[model samples]
Target: MGSAREALLDAAYEAIVSGDWAGARMADLAARAGVSRQTLYNEFGNRDQLAAALALREAERFRALTGQAAREAEGDAGAATAAAVTAALTAALDNPLIKATLTDDTSGLLPYLTTRSAAIMDVFREDSVAIFVERWPDLALRPDVTAEVGWICETAFRLVISHLIVATEPVETTSRHIAEVVRRLMRDLTTT
Candidate 1:
């Protein structure tokens, strides 16, 4: 059994999934979670807060999936990086919220996730860095190299995100390109 906050988040996610962010009303979310609007307000403060919470929760979920992909690749750094990128790309392609977030029109949630998401982006990058450092400790090289690797990994993430947003080519092609980049990065790091 989760807390009211988690339950409310779940309800909010379901509402957002079933409909759209704009359509997910506070009353509906409250009713879905068996809570009152006042309780929802008290828990999340406002709709913007609720949206932020939702985005954070989803980011955590995506990071977990990416981390699992890295872990599943065992100790092979290149494999781990490629696996993580593949998982992220696949998830982005499959998830509606991600698709909506990258799209230009509707949802009104894209800016919350992209342009206005410095804090969330920081968290996302940190999480990815942790995953990379865990799987490929070489990424933790001398003097803040971990930060460098983290930024590189985040760049790959952004590239994949861009591919999803642009929808210019097949996901497989973008995934292959990212995997190659990760492979090259791993090679360069290990060689240096």
Candidate 2:
């Protein structure tokens, strides 16, 4: 049942990404996933829940990308972290599914992109804490602060990326400035 629920959500999302906003309709989603309309309602509650699920799933992908960036920060933590952060920001800006997700005019996709998907934000923060701790164990006095730092870092990253991606701002113009700010923030706060 869980697998079917996920399959329905995946199908709904695929339709959405391919410019089939109408397919996000509960009946269409059910048909696409070979499920009954009652099943969708029973499992996911409503269309909005389905959309939120899809958003969360996409957020997981972003988390995976960040995890890759963190793993790359293995030994030489500072330089590697700076590079990873820049790369993560770039990926968030360039993510195609995110672009399409934001393009949905009906479901208020932009707010969902930031607000409802906040759960995944926590996932990234926790994951980054582990990665950063592995790289810079002595940086924090209490050990748990890495998650706090990561949350700030990701929030700052989202601010810049949201502006650039949604507003089509010049990435080159803002990248260096944002990079410096993030660097200083991490250096100042993370050091005990």
Candidate 3:
């Protein structure tokens, strides 16, 4: 990404966080980014595209954080799972854009994180499965187990999204429970 594009995205995020996405004009965002409105349009095509790009960028950041947490957990798959979930939930709690979108329905940015999140979900699932296979190479040797691993990754990602939208427990408690369930599931699959 060029500096101009980065600036535009930063400005868009700030605008959405401070107010509503629907109320944010292209010209205003461009001015905030220190670029022309035409430049913003050239980079993003339109507001919807810009919004999608911003949402994807944020998702990627979360993905990177979770991946890093998993990698830093040494050789313990359960510990890696726990660390990844904790990192995601903790980051979501502090993300102003997430808070803004969840609280303000009129933001027009909710779909990118919720109902229309297929792209984000797909990337997360793929990355998660890769992480699992890398940590537990035996899973990749069995087709059935690999499929189960994908399902588990999808389930874990959905659980994280659910917690982000509606929290029932503390981050630590939720993450620990998820890790325990995942560990049991993996154990059963491996032992079978």
Q: Which candidate is the best by TM-score?
A: 3
After superposing candidate 1 on the true structure, give the runs of residues whose Cα lies further than 4 Å from its correct spot: 74-78, 99-106
Task: Measure candidate 2: CA RMSD.
Answer: 3.2
lDDT of 2 by residue, 65-108 (tens): 75686577544444544555566567766765676766666544
Task: Candidate 3: give the clashing pairs.
Answer: none
Q: What TM-score would candidate 2 get against the native?
A: 0.78
Off by over 4 Å in 2: 74-82, 89-95, 139-144, 147-151, 167-176
TM-score of each: 0.81, 0.78, 0.90
Could you tell which candidate, 1 or 2, scores higher by lDDT?
1
Please write out the lDDT profile of model 3 over residues 1-192, one tens digit for every residue: 499999999998998888846777899999999999999999999998988888888899999999989988874556778999999999988999999888887667789877888888887888888898888788889998888988888888888888888999999999988888788778876666
| Best candidate (score: lDDT) | 3
lDDT of 2 at 87: 63
9-111 in candidate 1: lDDT tens per residue?
8887776665555766888888888988898999999887887888888878877898788778765555676677678778887897776565525455676
RMSD of each: 2.8, 3.2, 1.9
* TM-score sort, best first: 3, 1, 2
